[model samples]
Target: MRFMKSFFLTTFNNHLIAYPTPINIHYAWSFGFLSLMCLTLQTVTGIFLAMHYTPHIALAFSSVEHTMRDVNFGWLTRYTHANGASMFFMVAYIHIFRGLYFGSYTKPKQWVWLVGIFIFTLMIMTAFMGYVLPWGQMSLWGATVMTNLVSALPMIGDYMVFWLWGGFSVDNATLNRFFSLHYTLPFVITATSLVHITLTHQEGSGNPLGIDSYSDKVNLYPYFVVKDTYGLFIFTFLFSVFLFFYPNLLGHSDNYVEANPMVTPNHIVPEWYFLPFYAILRSVPHKLWGVIAMLSSIIILSFIPWLHSTETRSSRFRPIYKIFYWTLVFCCLLLGWIGGMPVEEPYITMGQVLSVYYFSYFLTTLPMLGTVENNLMNYFNK
Candidate 1:
């Protein structure tokens, strides 16, 4: 009873009590709160989808269409879940870029950001698997091509592919397992989110200036809660617009057809969020190198804290670094665009250039910029 009272009081004080937050936080910080609201939206809609969705390979596609054609409010549920995935990714990218811009990944709480990256990776895997459950033509071959990438691994690659497929190719077992895992992984993401939030709380939120443990620190309650609540309402409004008006905007027309393994899609592209890595995969003539590079791009992000050397907290103070950082952002956007195009000569060439910039920005430029800034600061001090 004592513990329960303490818990209740703590919750009330943290959420209800008006508190000041770092005034330096910009609207970019709103993205994380918006993401939380999206998670709530996705979860509610996803549960509704599960009730109507048939996970069986033979019935899954039919089940989706049935929900659309027959079930009351089923179309809204389905579209909300589908487009919610896109919206979740869209918000997540902005949240991540916000972290990058503010240098939020550096310092005493770098682990929090790293865990967020892992969540992002898991989210991608979950989305990829979920995309296959509709059992459309693209879904069928998309699963096939994607799962086959594991075969590029060393000795056990072929074995892993067969294990994932439960056979020589993607079939009933694959769909069933994907359905099971898709349902399971989001909860894992939620758990990781708890850890992410805890870590951030322990470190306390970073400011635009990148300073830590400043005396001017404010309580996180009323200030952020109000801002976050407002952000959530705005996100919900946008989500509702998609839910009602442009439900199919993020989905593929090819997905309306049932899974036909024999007939391949003319352009077998994954969703737009995945295009950059997919482009990386297709850019290479060899499957193995492409797979390696694709996975490396995400893993490399974990090493960023170590890659950068400067002691400063914010880019506002590091003018030269800010220029290169924005350039990297542009390069990433360019890479995403190229990922959707056919791997013709010019397209492939452009992808290669962007990919190089992507790696160079992290590995070479970040380190050099940090060192240069340190030297300048030392000279000024003298």
Candidate 2:
């Protein structure tokens, strides 16, 4: 027993507790831990919800309604799972934005950042699939609408759509596949998260000052571990507020109605987390280009580490980057606002323009800044 304790201590102490980390990292650092906690909450709650859920089109909506009305504490479980998803995305976006502002995606940590992006992509897929399992009006039509995007793929469009739907439309087979994938992907995400955390541990944490931590390293135990715990508590309190008080606040009213093939909602808005990308999709005039642009919005993010180059690591040190960094942030928030609005007139025009600025910031602004900044840094050093 003593030997086993020693072995456990050695592994954890060396790999995690004794791991050297930047001392000055602020509350932003805590969001990573908060995100993991949210995912955990989601997974547990989802498992319970799934046990009672029926993936069949005929039974799916009624099954969820039964779970809410009949099973002991079913409403609580359902609300927790639904709200937990929102909280997870909320925590994740904050984590991503924080990394972006501090240049955490730069060299050495690029692979780690990539892992983070992969996890985010998996989360999105998992969420989209899970949304369909409830089998509501929004679920049926949303699946049909989104899957129909494949029809824009030129000659092979119908074939792809047939495969995606398992037939001509969103039916039983589609729901079954969605449930299977939705139930499975969270565990995959959890496993990927372990890799992400391991890579993060190898490099230690980055900071706002953006300097190397070797000069002022501190162990993860007591300080960082405790700090992360406190952060989790804060997140939990806020999450509980949503679960208990306002369960449907983030959900669309259209989703509560049973799906009807002939009926369509006046407006088909996605969940809040996906709104920005949805806006981007509608921004383009053409179908294929719209899908490409929407996808590029996310795919482009992974290339950011290579897209920009500079000697300095943090935006705090780069005056020009700091300005554009905030511009990117504002653009994302504006896109979210535009996403929730009807895609007509002034809103459509505004979305298209914002989409242009969004891509330019990544393609044009960052690369040019990197070249200019690298030269400026070199001239000063000499």
Candidate 3:
């Protein structure tokens, strides 16, 4: 035990003494630490909820209610776990945006950022499937509708949907499988977290300068560790408040009731985190095309490193990159907003336009910016 303690202490000391990090990382950088804090909170609260959660369809709904009303602090467990999902997504989005703003996805750390994106995608899947476990109206139909999307494929799509459901429809087998996957995916994500952190330490954190091995870089300890701790405190404070008081704030009222296959939800919006990509799916006029576009939106994010061309790390020095960056951000927001509205001709048209811009930003605009910036830099040098 002494040896273990000493090893940790020494490791902490080494990281603390490493270097001086840039002071310009901004509040955006706080999100990564906040996300870590949120993960812990979610894990703890989730474990408690699991103790009272019933996996069987017959008892799952009542089991949740039992915990909420009967078990000691069961309500707290329920609310915290539910609300924490929202908090997790909130911090994750900020983390991803911070990476984008600082070019943290560039070489050396590309795999780290890619892992982060993978975690993000997995998180969405986990949350989506987990939300269905309560056996609520939205939970049932939402699972049904979303899973049925897999059937949109030509040959394997129907088979895939059937496989996911474990039956012809969203029934007992489906719940059991979703529950199993939901329980398992977090561990997978935890492993991915290790990869993310290892890669992060290898490349070191991206400073506001976005350059590698710059004199401005700082050690992970006293500086960021301290700053990260502060963010954790803030996150903890808010999370505690939710756990104690407003735990259900992030959940839908319909989820409290048992799932009724006969009753379809009027407006079945998935949890907020899935809104943007879900919107992208709803935007397409063609069934297959919608699925393709929605999936492309996610997979395309990984290609950003190859696409973005500016020689500089930070967008601060690249005027064109900054323009394109903000444009992409706006387009994403637009896509998200359109995703919630009723599917219509105009909305579909708008989604297509934004989708075009979205891909263009990756495939065309970023490359163009790099080339244009290179030319300008050369001209100035000459």
Candidate 4:
């Protein structure tokens, strides 16, 4: 019993069960731990699916069908994995935005946020690779469009595309490599997430009140464990509902058709989670410039902690900033809506307009808010 108690003190109990937590955290904090749980679920399901999956272009689609129709409970595993990816992103996006709103991206927490971004980048890469494993219509066309975007670069553009596909275009090599990466990247995310959690625990969780606690910390055993478990149960229940009931809700009908290299779909769309950035990619007139615009949108996320220069942390304390923040959120939604529309007039125009506002919020509003907001509000006061 003594040895067991010593082992417990050194292992799970110390690091997980009894870890320190901020007393003032809310449901938003629950999403981070939930994202971790979702990742585990995704990785486990993916491993089992992989055991039966064939990554060849000829066999990939059929293998997926075989897994779904022939293998024992394979349908459940595949659906869980598919729906799990969406759930993972949903929780992660909420977790990220919560950090943004509550100012968890500020100074000492900067490393934590950066590691979180690393995890996100890996997730996107992993998901993109996973999407192609089915070798369906959208999977093929989507892979083609995205990979061909690399050819827009100046000199090495062709080389970049060639290097990625290992051929003139996406084929068996591409499918084989994508499957390998899809199987590999979750482990990367898992390792990076561990670093993120360690750094976060080291920094301690930020609170809504934007206050840090040196002495006010609470044990993770009961309070937060129960709260996070409660949140996970609700989240899992809702996710399972989609898994069993509306399995195809987040997937596209186009993907139901198998690959035909000679034929292209009337319209190609990436997944819903990627829509806002996809809209940005198509908003510009020039192909190369459009590619840059899309990359810029993502690259800009890393600089947010430095961009909004202020002593203030949380948007809760800054009334003016909250308005701008919500406007940015609205801009993202508009971009997403525009992404699914035909690139013809009003949609293109609308996408271009919203794209400007998206950048403006980060590049203009945030930097300028510190200088003008108080004066503008004070002028109104007088």
Candidate 5:
């Protein structure tokens, strides 16, 4: 027992206290720590909320209302869990963008990036399941629409959809399955997150300058710990503002109404975080192709470590790459905006065009840009 105690303490100190971090990394690096905090918040609040939640179709909505109105501080728990999801994704997206901009996916850190992407995919699955728990009008229909997309597969599509539904349609069985999975996946994510951090520490953290900082590193304690704490305080303040002042700002009004299978909403939209991929899914004319496009939009990110040919890691040294990076950012924002808009002419056309650019940015532009930058460097040296 004494040996075990010492072993654990030594491990903690090594990873958390004495870990070497790049000295030049700034507030953006803190987002990774912030993401971990969001996950913890979500897990704690989810556990509390689940205690009062009923997964049955007949009582699911009312159970949520009962928890809100009757249980002490239940509204706080529910809102925190709900909005905390958005916070998690917000922090995660920033962390990912920081990785992309600094080229954190390069060389030894490749597995760290890959594991982070896996965590993200799990987050999307968990969030999608959680969204259906309230059994609201939007929740029911959203589940129906999203599950139906599985039928786009060639052979076992219908069977897979049936398995996911656990019935002919979105009903009590579906809710039960989703609730079970939602309650379970966070623990899985937490475990996966440990792997991600372990891999990140194994390779050491990257910096804004995107250069080796092994000889000029600082301990994770004191300096970075203090900086991360400051970031946490600021993040808590903003989170509290949404929690107290505008708890439902990120939610859809249609969700306040109880689900009625007989009635369908005019616009069946998903949460804000999913809008970019949703736009890609809708942009394609065929259902199978649209689903493939939506899935590819995310999967393509995994290929970045291979697709990028430049030896340079940071956008700071690459002027042309920096411009293209921001353009890709704009393209994503436009896709997200287009996702929420009605499926009409100009929106459809716009989405199609941007979707093309989105793939092009990954497949053609990154590789070609690297070649151009390499050529420019060679000519200047001559």
Candidate 6:
């Protein structure tokens, strides 16, 4: 028993306490830790919510209501779980953007980036399924619209849609399946997150300078742990403002109504986190092409490690890349805005233009800009 205890303590110290981290990494580096905290909060609250949630379509909405109104502090539990999803995505996006800015995906850290992308994809799937569990108007229709996109595939599309729905339409089977997967996929995310952290530690953390800091590294304990704790305090304060003050601010008003297939809402929109991709989907007229575009928008990110041509990693060192990177961020925010607007007149045209630029920024701009920067640097040195 003593041997086992000693072994466990030593392993923990090696991985968590004494781990070497780049000395110059900033507070932005804390988002990865924040994301883990969000996941843990979601998982614990989800388990409690599940104890009272019904997977059947007929009772799902009422069960959620019961949990909110009848159960002790159930409202708090539900709100935390719901808002926690938003907080999770917010932190994850910041973490991803920070990685991009510091070129964390370059060289030896590519696997870490790839695993992080996989975790992100899983989060999208899991969040969509969780949205459907409330059995609200937007929830049902959002699931219908997203799952139907699978049918846009050439041959197996319809079959895949059927398999996803478990019937001709989104019904009880679909709810049960989504609930089960929603309950299970978080554990999968947890496992994958371990792999992600392991890979990151193996490659070591990247700093703002985007260079090897092997000689100037510091232990994960004390200094960085205190920094992360400070970040956590700020995060918790903001999270509480939303959780306690305005929980439903992030949710759709239409979702307050129980799902009625016969009476469709005037507009069907997904959660805010999904808006940018949803805009990309709506930009194309053809169903198949639109679906392809939407999927490509995300999948293209995974290829950035190979696409970039310059040896320089940090945007701070690459002036041209820094301009384009911020422009890309603006493009995403614009796409997200266009996504929530009515698909008519100017919105459609704007979405089309933004969508085109979005893909081009990934495929053409990144590689070409990197090449130009490399050429400029060589010319100056020569």
Best of the candidates, lDDT = 5
Q: Each candidate's lDDT (Cα)? A: 0.84, 0.90, 0.81, 0.90, 0.95, 0.94
Candidate number with the higher TM-score (3 or 6): 6
Per-residue lDDT tens digits for candidate 1, residues 25-122, read 87788898777766777778777888889888789999999998899988878888899899999999999888888889898868988999999999
Lowest lDDT block of 10, candidate 6: 260-269
TM-score between model 5 and native = 0.99
**lDDT for each residue of candidate 5 in 1-382, tens digit (9 for 90 to 100):** 9999999999999998999888889999999999999999999999999889889999999999999999999889888988999999999999999898999999989999999999999999999999999999999999999999999999999999999999999998999999999999999999999999999988888988888887889899989999999999999999999999999999899999999999999999999999999999999999999999999999999999998898999999999999999999999999999999999989999999999999999999999999999999999999
Among residues 3 or more apart in sequence or in different chains, the pairs in candidate 3 whose N, CA or C atoms overlap within 3 Å are 19-219, 20-217, 20-218, 21-217, 21-218, 279-339
The 10-residue segment with the lowest total lDDT in model 4 = 370-379
- Sum up the clashes in candidate 4: 0
- Give the alpha carbon lDDT tens digit for every residue of 1-382 in model 4: 9999899787687668878887888899899989999999999999999999998988999999999999999999999998899999889889988988988898888889888988998999999999989999999999999999999999999999999998988999999999999999999999999899888877887999887778788889899899989998999789979988999999989888999999999999998889999999999999999999998998888898888677678888799889888888788888988898888999999999999998888898888896676667578889
Which digits, one per residue and each the tens of the lDDT, describe model 6 over residues 119-196? Answer: 999999999999999999999999999999999989999999999999999999999999999999999999999999
What lDDT tens digits, residue by residue, belong to model 3 across residues 1-382? Answer: 9999999887666545664556567667889768776777777777788888888878889988999899997877777788889989988987887788788888877898789999988988889889998888889889988998888889899899989988899888988888888888888888888788767766777777776656655565567777777877877888788777776676778887788877777778888678788877876768898889889988988987887777687888877788878888898888877877777778888987887888888788877878888999999999
Residue 281 of model 6 has an lDDT of 96
Pick by TM-score: 2 or 6, better one: 6
Q: What's every prediction's RMSD, in angstroms?
A: 1.8, 1.8, 2.4, 2.4, 0.7, 1.0
Model 2 TM-score on a 0 to 1 scale: 0.96
Model 5 misplacement above 4 A? none
In model 4, which runs have C-alpha deviations exceeding 4 angstroms?
1-8, 373-382
